[model samples]
Structure formats: C-alpha cells, structure tokens
Target: MSDIGISTKAMGKSGVTFSPLKVLKGFIPKLDTKAIVKNALISLASILLFVLLWHLGANYLFNIEATAKIEKARTEQGAEAAAQMEACILSGDVSCQPNTLPSPQQVIVAAQNLWADHLSISAKKTAFKAKVATTNADRKAQGLKPIKYTGRPSFIDQILTSIKTVFAGFLLAMFIAIPIGIITGLNENLKTAFNWLIQIFKPVSPVVWLLLVFMIVKTLIRDPELDKSFIIAAISVGLCAMWATLVNTSLGVSSVKTDYMNVAKVLQLSLGKKIFKIIIPSSIPLIFTGLRITVSVAWMVLIAIELLAQSPGLGSFVWEEFQNGANDSNAKIIVAMFVIGIIGFLLDRVMLFVQQSVSFETQ
Candidate 1:
C-alpha cells in the first residue's frame, strides 16, 4: 500500500493519469453540437430563400420578354408566326430565349463554362511555354526578347489581375498616406494648412482621378512594352482610396494619449523613437481601421478605373460581356459580380484579422 501511494504521487508529478474515465475525457473534445447544427441549418435556409427569390425574379422577367416577342409576331405575321414563336421559345432555342436576368441554374452553367475556359487557357499556356522554351533560351543567348504568349486572359486570370492591381494601389495609398498623415498630425499648423487640400480631394470622383492619371501616365510611360493602362488604373485607385487612410491616420496619430507622449518626453526619446514607440503603437487600432477602409475603397474604385483605363480585369470583363450580349452574358456578369463581392468581403476580413493581431486594444 505504501509503495502504491508513492507511485501515485510520482504519477501526479509527471501529469500521468491511469483512469478510463479521465482517458476518455482527454480523447473526446467538448463541443456544442446543437449550436453548430442550428447555425448550419439557418445558413442553409437563408441560402435557399435567396435562390428561390432569384428564380422567381428571373422567371418573371423572362416571361414578360417572351410574351412581348410573341405578341409582336402575332401583330405583324398573324397566328402562325405567333404559334411558331411560342413553340421556338418552348423548345428552349437559344435564339428565341429571352435575354433577361438568368436563373441560378444559368449562372451555375456560366460559372462552369468560365472554369472550363480557364482550364483550356491554362493548357494552352503550358504548351506555349514548352514550345518556346528552346527559342527563349537561344534569344537570351542572342540578347533579344523572348517570345511571349499574346492570347487573351481567362476569367481567373482577370480576377488575379484585378487583385494584383488593387494590392498595388493599396500599397501606394499606405506609403503615401501614412507619412503625410504623420507629418501633418505631428504639427498643428501643418494639419490646418493641409486640411483644405485633403477635404477638396477627398470627394473627387474616381473617373476624374483616372483621367488625371491617364494624362500623366501617357506622357511619362513612353515604352511600348510597358503597361500604361495598368499604371493609370493603379494610380487612380490609389488616389481615390488614400483619403480614407490619410484622414484616419491623421485622426489616430493626433488622438494618441497625452500621457504616453509625456512618458516619451520624460524618457528623452528622440523624434523617431517617439513616433515609432509611442505614437505608432497607440495609433495602431485606428490606423488599421483606416487601412481596412482604404482597401475597401481601393477595390470599389478599381473596377471603374480599370474600365476607364482598359485594364484587363473584372471591369473589362464586365464591359466586354455587356457589349457581347450573348445568351450567357448576363449570367457571366452576375458571376463576376458575386466574385467581386466575395473578394471584397474577404479582403476586409483579412484586414480586420491583421488589425486585431497587431493592436493591443483589439487583443
């Protein structure tokens, strides 16, 4: 009995237990299964409701257009033409189908077609790369440019391009806004002087920014190989989006606690140290908030800027589809719309996560 008690105490010290119930508890995680089930069911129901509403709306518009077509045929070409038009529509001929809002099924089909196009494009790119590998190597030896793929970008490629453009714009906004904001925030007179400029530019339209950027980029970027449209779009997006970050950063820095500043002064911290250690740390939450807003604004303006600049991105995709007016064009546009919204939501969430990770208040 004395030896068993000693062994039990030793096991306790080592955090080793030998009970069936305790082992079972350790292996089984505690979870609120009911809550999980309830949330899943609610989400399912919501999605179903949205799909149902979309179906109804699409069907209503489709019927109205179809009825008008039939009526026009009857008025001009008599009962036989009207009957033929009705039969054509009933037979689900693409030519006779109403070019209105597409149902969910049509959107799904569009999405699948886009995916197939992406795959086909990817295969072609791979083949092109393989075919040019030897020629590219010889060109490098001869000091000439290698052959490049000149095919149009697929849907996925456009999405990636748009994402890249937005990120470039966001970086530009951060770099420009933060330094100016800090300088303005540090000096009362500077803030007062710059207030008018900030206020004036903050409400400027994205189209105006794009035009301004286009004029400058066209003059500055004379290289035929350089992507002038991308530069203009990125710069315009940056200019349009930076105001939010600039304003928020200024507010955050100016609003830093006096107590922290006093401590920094008491410690004889240098200007750089004071700004980095005291001001920046205190202003992180608000600065991140501003950054999040800036990202959102950048993404929002990017579409318009891309459209104006003729950048090969979602905006261009949307414009091209609208002009094409194919049977699947509307569905494709809707798919792009959903993709844009989802990406925007994800970007905001990512920013929020980063903000929470870095900010003490959020933590």
Candidate 2:
C-alpha cells in the first residue's frame, strides 16, 4: 500500500513538472539540423545585397554614358518618369543601354582579350601611367578582340611560383625553429628572455618588415636582382614564421608532465633520447598547430611581399593584373583572387591533414 501510494505521488509530481522543451517539442516544429544552412543563406543574401549596392553606386557615380542618359531622362522628367524608370534598370547599372554590373557575357569577352590579345599601340602609350583606374563594372569587356594575360609566366606558372615559394619558406621555418626551440626549451632563462622579443616581432606588420628587409637588402647587397626578389620575399616570410614555431615548440617541450620528467630522471635516460622520444612526441600537437599557423601567415606574407617587392609570386601577378588597363583585366584579377583563395585553403588543409596523421594514436 505504501509503495503504491509513493508511485501515485511520484506520478502526480511528474504531471506538475514544467519542461518548456518537452512542451515545445510536442507543439512546435522541429529545430533545424544545420544552422549553417540558414547562416549560409543569410550570408549569400548579404553578399548579393552588397554586390547590387556596389554596382548601383559605381554606375551612378562613374559610368559617364549611363550618367548622361540618366541626367537627360531626369531633365525630361514629367508624369512618365516613374514609368520610364523601369526601362533604365538593366543588369546592375542605371543606363540608356541595359547593365549595372557587367553581364557575364561582357566580362567573358573582356577576359578573353586579357588572356589572348596582344597590347595595342594605344595601350603602349598609356602603359607607363596609372590613369586607367576604372572599376571592374565600368571596364566590362565587349567585342571580339580579347585582353591578354601575358603573365611573366602564365596563370599556372604564377600559381606554381607562389606555392613553391610558400613551401620553401615553411620548410625553412620548421628547420630553423626546431633546434633553436629545443635549446630554448632546455634553458629556462633563454626561453623567457627570447619569448619577449618573439612576442614583439610576431605581432609586427609584415609590410613594415618587408620595407625594412628591402632597405637592408638595398644597403647590403648593392644592385639587387629583380629575378631574385622572389627568393628574398620567401626568406622574409620564413623569418616572420620563426617566432610562432619557436614559442610553440619551446612551450610544448618544456610542458612534458612532471611524472614523465621524473621517470626519465629515475631511468637516467640519455638527454638525446629524452628529448627525441619524450619531449618532441609529447609536444607534437602544440608544435604542429604552431607550424600550421606559421604556414598560413607565411602565405599571406608571401602575397604581400610579392606585391610590394614586384616578385614573381601570386601577389605580383594580382597587382600586375589590377594595373593592366585592358577591358578584361578586371576579370583576370577576379580569377587570380579565386586562385589565391583556393591555394591558401589547400595549404591549410595539407597542414591539417599532416597534424591529424602525425599525432600519437591512443591504443
């Protein structure tokens, strides 16, 4: 009887319990599995909005023909202005002719000229100056003659150059970072002292660093070879990457658990073995994470360095394309932008895979 009474009371209590989730689950719709889906949709909407606004703004601000047409139409403003407004709306720009952002058709035409056509005598006249500073939408390509890419190499060549430079810098960073980091890890005083310097330089801007390097090279190496600019850029990038590896590696090495340190001491483990077997293996994750970050930062620096140094890397290629005062040059620049993004992503993925593969697996 007592058991039955207790069960009845528990059931009565359960009925009184308020659970919004339970009530909502029964009454409301199921929550979305992918919050990213909605976020992505929103992000896409924002991008479209930005693109639309930018197109309208650029066309309204700079498209002389379109502006002329608009002024004419507005001057003729009468009862029919509202009705005629629809005729002016074309592609992304306000125009007597239809278009805001250049249509794909226009850009495609422009892109072909950049990739294939030779420079014209007219282009040669304007080549030395920066006067062709038109926005992408304004310079949308039209007609049959395409723009030329005439990249120092080619698109593939530029991609390869940038990748090679980044890899070289990253590899050099790893090599230099390890031995020094290990030494610093073994010495408390050295580690603490250099850590301060590393912090200072790590946060310093790469652009400033490049200018400093440029000045140093100019002062020291009289008559710098433009061809060797890429090499110089890579070295600068590697140097910039040095601190992260040093700090992470030192922290990782010094952080081997106390128990492990004591075990090594008790066993009288050789210093070499202790470092190789215990310290490095234990700190693998931290060390690799630093390397990953270093490489990504190096890639960014590589592009910036290339841009400033006029090096034969992706950055220079992008700058060159942007400067090209041809119809399809903007398209080429856009393509280069995508190429840089893809390459950067791939480099990151490669490091991530390396981290995943190299980490010690628990039995």
Candidate 3:
C-alpha cells in the first residue's frame, strides 16, 4: 500500500511518470529516418559514379598518349625501339605516362601528399621556433625583433593565408560601404552626387583595382617589412566587392517605412538614435542580403587579385603548379581546384546562415 501510494505521489495529478522509452518515442516520430538514409545512399552513389567516369577518361587519355609514343618510335627508329617504348609504358614508368587529366585516385593521392607536406613543414617550424626560443628572448630583452622562420609555406599554410586575406578584404568593404551608404540614403542630394561614382566604379575589373591600389599603397606604405602583396590583394578585393554592399545598403536605408520615420520624429530621436534604433533594425534583412553578396564577390575576385599581387595563397599555388608541369602537377592542380570550389561553397553557406540568423523572414 505504501509503495502504491509513493508511486501515485510520483505520478502527481496527471497520473503519469517519466519514461525514457516514451521520450525516445516522441523524438522518433519527428525524424524521417527512411528519407535520411535514402538521401545518404543517393549522395554516395553519385560520388562513386563520378569517380568511375573520371577513371575511364584518365585511362583513355593515357592509352592515346602511350600509343602515340609507340607509333612515333616505330616510324622514326625501328620496330625494336617501338617494342622497347611499349615495354617502358607497360612497366608503370612515370616518364612514359601522359600528363593530362588526373584520375580521382591521383587527386586523392595529391591531397594526401599535401597533407603530409603540411605536417612536415609544421614539424620543421616547431623545431625552428624551439631552436630560436632563447635567441628570440635575448632579442626581445635587447629591444630587437625576434628571429622568424623563413621556410616555404605548405599547401595548408597557403589556404590559411587566402582565408585571412579574404576576411580582411570583407571587413574593409563593410567599413567603407556602410557609412557612405547610410549618409547617402539619408539625403537625396548625397545619393545623386554618389550615384555617378558608384556606377562608374562598380564595373571596374579586379586587375584594374589591383593596379590602382598598388600605385597608391606603394606610394604611401614605404615600410620594407610590410607585406605589400597581401595589402594590395586585400585592398583590390575590397574595392572590387564593396559596390554591391554600398548599393544595397543605400536602397535598404531609403526603403524604411514612412510610419517608422514618423514615429522616430515624434519621439524626437537624435540622428544617431534614429539610425541605430529604427533605420538599422528595419534595414537588417536587406543589409544582410547585400553583405552575403559582398562576401561572395570578395571570394570570387580574391584569386585573381592574389594572383596579380603574388600573394602567398591558393592563386599563387595554382600558378606555380601550372608552371611546374611535373607528372603530379596536374593532380595537384586538380586538388587545388576542388579545394577552391569547396571553400567558396562553404563561405557562401556561412554567409547565408548568418543572414538567416538575423532576419525574421528567414526564421
């Protein structure tokens, strides 16, 4: 009787007790497991099909090159030389292999090689830092600069450099565009005055921007220790990408509802308060949309700017690999190409997520 009474008390007025099984059942109904499995399977199948096609294409190109080499030997030298060429090709000699489109497997191998190279470089950097620790400390005590590692950067380091450059450019774009956009949006005359400038610069090429920035930065920044290439690339990227944000911000601020403006006036809010409390809040969705576009544009133009500026990033890596023309160079290039695409996709997704997070409509 006491046990029954205790159980009833635990159940409370609802006469129900907590059950782990019941909670699990509640969550199970919310999840469509079959659909998730189906989608996963479909994605796997698609990747496999792509790999198979790539393998077939790579083999076809290899055979064509091999046959050409053998035929050339037969025509110029002799049947004996042709047989030797065929034997060399069949022996899995890299010299006889065609340097064309790499198979998916080759790309995978290249990626692994890059990762290994990064690890090796990281180890070297660590050892170098340790070796200089005491010397660096002495230098610091003497008010001198610390010794730094000057080794070549690995593929991973290049990737990090690129990400840093893009973010720097993005921040610059935001800082310059938002204030100008707000000022212009607040006054018709300002908008009219800025319209021509925006229209003229909006269509300018990234290379042109790079050259313009290079000219200005070179004239201004005379410090030899500063990374001029990185500065030029970042500035060029910002200049090329800021127009979308500027235009969108202006449009957003101008499109605020008349009722909100009237309310702000009734409250007798200061210019700053009105902008901060009403204008910005109302314009957030469009502002975020513009920001999203700006980020995408910045990333797209970054490669070109980095290439021209000779910034130690993926752009430089690609250029170097192309010039290398080694047996594995094509594979490495393919690897970089895929990395670029994946990173671009991720950046867009991140921007989209941020936009959705702040916008009520998206929520």
Best lDDT among the predictions, by candidate number: 1
What RMSD value applies to candidate 3? 4.3
Note each model's CA RMSD in angstroms.
4.1, 14.9, 4.3
Error of 1 at 28 (Å): 12
lDDT by residue for model 3 (169-249), tens: 999999999889888888899999999999999999999999999999999999999999999999888989998889989
Better of 1 and 3 by lDDT: 1
- Model 2: lDDT equals 0.72
lDDT of 2 by residue, 63-144 (tens): 6656565666677885376346535444443233533334344455654654554345335434623343343224555433
Worst lDDT run of 10 residues, candidate 3, spans 20-29
Task: Point out the worst 10-residue segment of candidate 1 by lDDT.
Answer: 18-27
TM-score: model 2 vs. ground truth = 0.63
Q: Please, what are the lDDT tens digits per residue for candidate 1 over residues 156-221?
A: 999999999999999999999988888888889999999999999999999999988888888988
What C-alpha lDDT do the candidate models reach, one value each?
Answer: 0.93, 0.72, 0.91
**Cα deviation in Å at residue 167, candidate 1?**
0.6
Residue 309, candidate 2: alpha-carbon lDDT: 76
Write the candidate numbers in order of decreasing lDDT.
Answer: 1, 3, 2
Model 2: how large is the Cα RMSD against the reference? 14.9
